[model samples]
Target: MSTVGAQSRGVLRAACRQVGLPDEGAQPIRIAGNAIWRLPGGIVARIGRPDGREIAERELAVARWLTDSGVRTVRPAIADGPVLVDGRPVTFWDELAPHRPGTAADVARLLKQMHQLTPPASLTLPPLEPLTKPTRRIAEAGLLTTDDRRWLQDHVGQLAADFAGLPAGLPAGLPLCALHGDAWDGNVAVDADGTAYLLDLENTCYGPPEWDLVSTAVKHLTTATVTAAAYEDFCSTYGMDVTSWPGYPVLAGIRELRMVTFALQIADEHPHARAEAQHRVDCLRGRKGPRPWTWTAVP
Candidate 1:
């Protein structure tokens, strides 16, 4: 195991003990912005960084709200709240049974359902802040050169200014409601019975529906990761094509910047991530066309 992986395992073990759950037979499922483990007894444990306690709390609250509203989502394992272990916040979830990955259509369908409902009065979801995460990632990317980081910082400033004027150009008819924030095929998982459920509720917030739709559209139009047919299917399923909207370019730009910074944040650990990050940066700087640029997920 890498040094970082071993440290994460140690922390997971300590978190299991703190929550009175056994660490034996725990298997690491994912390691990215967070470390996820499938512990024994049908429990999944997510360990966040020390600074992500607020995110953990919001995720727990979002899960409870979704469950109460009959929205299909991963359920929380413990009712009390997230547990703090070794300064990292840990939240437990019911381990879903082995299942197939969800399709783009499934993502669109679930997002449509989420967008149709109003959040409970008690639930206070923050507005969608597209730049907050990418800005932090650019600032903290250890592998980024001073010049590269400065360039990204400037790009962020420009995007923020552009975003401020986007609302006026956006189409109406869809009421502002709770959004899945990070709605994408990767965030949707299917159960054994072919029922799709949303995962990763950490990004759930009150925002325009376009914020959710742009992720998939950009995948098809800008990155080419998702197929044109799949993009059409997603739009057909959701009854909206955000790419047709006048304000789409602004949202698409912000999404691309987020994707670039997301990969750059983990460039130090994965060679693929580093290459993809640089490729995206070059594309953003207009040195290369965006169509053929492909960003790989870190394995």
Candidate 2:
């Protein structure tokens, strides 16, 4: 294992022990902003950074709220966390196995359901802040040139201004509700019984429903990552074509910037991501056409 992987495993092991759960035979699930481990006894542990306690707590609250609201989402395990272990927040979740990733249509259906409900009064969900992640990623990026960084910073500023002015230009009667800020097919998991469940509750926030719908639309329109048929199914299922919405260009630009910055942020650790990140940056800066540009997650 690499040094960071080993350290993450150590933290996972310690977190399991702290929670009085068996640490042996834990398997890594993902290693992004948080380190996720599938611990023994059908439990999954998510270890967040030391300073991410607020996000961890908010995620836990969202999970509990979603469960109470009868939404099909990943359930929290029987443990007291968002627990502080070694200054990091470790939350446990029930492992959903015998499951496959959901289709784009599945995502649209779940998002539609979520958009229909009012967020609980006690939750104190924050307003959607679209520029935060991408700005942070750009600032932390080591490979970006001074010009590239400046361009991204300016783009972020412009997007923030655009987002602030979105309310006036949105389609009339567009319902505003709590959004699964990063909803996409990849975040939807399907069980053995064909029940689709939403995962990754950390980004839950209040926003226009169109924000959640843009992922699939952009995938089909800009990148070829998702098929046209799947995108059509999503639009049909969700009952709206986000691409045709007046506010789409702004949302899509923000999403694209986020995607590019995300890829660039990890380029130093994942060498394979460097070329794709550069390609995205070039496209964003108008050096190349956006069409046919491929973007992939860090491996």
Candidate 3:
């Protein structure tokens, strides 16, 4: 199920009753690591909002495509070409049972497997939502302290790329895959039993496997061994293309910047999150690499 508002949730509850999936009420569940009250028995009946209609269509389509490719996902419902609840758009899904793991190795590998799955050629999706604009917003809004801006700025020159040698177009007939644009840790969920379910496909799009990988690297549990081993296991399972690393690594900085930008927009919603976002910018600034780890929207 997706996120929903108060009245929208009521409208969906009615729809569920009409469809024979009568719900008692929403039992509070932590979906996508966010507190959402999904209908007792229906996932779609729980979400409310029209702003996500276009995105919902894409995410549901990609979810089906990925399911066919052997990835475990929340199945989107089919309800007479999208349902309306008090003017808000709502989608349904079967409640997924997942297990959360304490370490990054397990989570990273799971994400890697999903990354390796190939999507149908006809599946044309959206563009990569880079981190540059978001970060710029944060800067302009006075969301960051002077120190943090300086930190992100220091990374600017270092991450610049040479576009001269870039390929004119993607390979003539290489397989493309369904990509989770905002494949951050918050989108992952683990049930008490230890199974994982990737969530929040609103940012789903069509792109390289790295679109998922670059963000997956920022783990709750940090360890180089876990990072390397998890990726190694994924490579062994999927035989990914590593020559793409140099490129994805640089792109991840953009992700960092994007994250900073998002924080500014939502910082008011949660105090701890705002503090942590600012702290994260500090962390990125301290970590030195061949390229700047701050956001860049060049592509």
TM-score per candidate, chains pooled: 0.95, 0.95, 0.65
Model 3 Cα lDDT, one tens digit per residue, 53-112: 666666677778777777766777663434555554556777665445324444455666
Best by lDDT: 1
Candidate 1 positional error at 28, Å: 0.9
lDDT of 2 by residue, 1-299 (tens): 76567888888878777778998888888876678888878999888877788888888888888878888998889535577777888899999977888999999999988888887778888888988989888998988999999999999999999899998787877767989999988899998899999999888999788899988887887777889899889999989989899899999999889888878876766666798888889989988875755666664
* Segments in model 2 whose C-alpha atoms lie over 4 Å from true places: none
lDDT of each: 0.86, 0.85, 0.54
**Model 3 lDDT vs. the true structure?**
0.54
Summed backbone clashes in each candidate are 0, 0, 11
* Candidate 1 per-residue lDDT over residues 250-290, each given as its tens digit: 88989999888887877765555777778778888877864
Which model, 2 or 3, shows the larger lDDT?
2
| Model 3: residue 277 alpha-carbon error in angstroms | 2.4
lDDT of 3 at 245: 53
Candidate 1, position 4, lDDT: 62
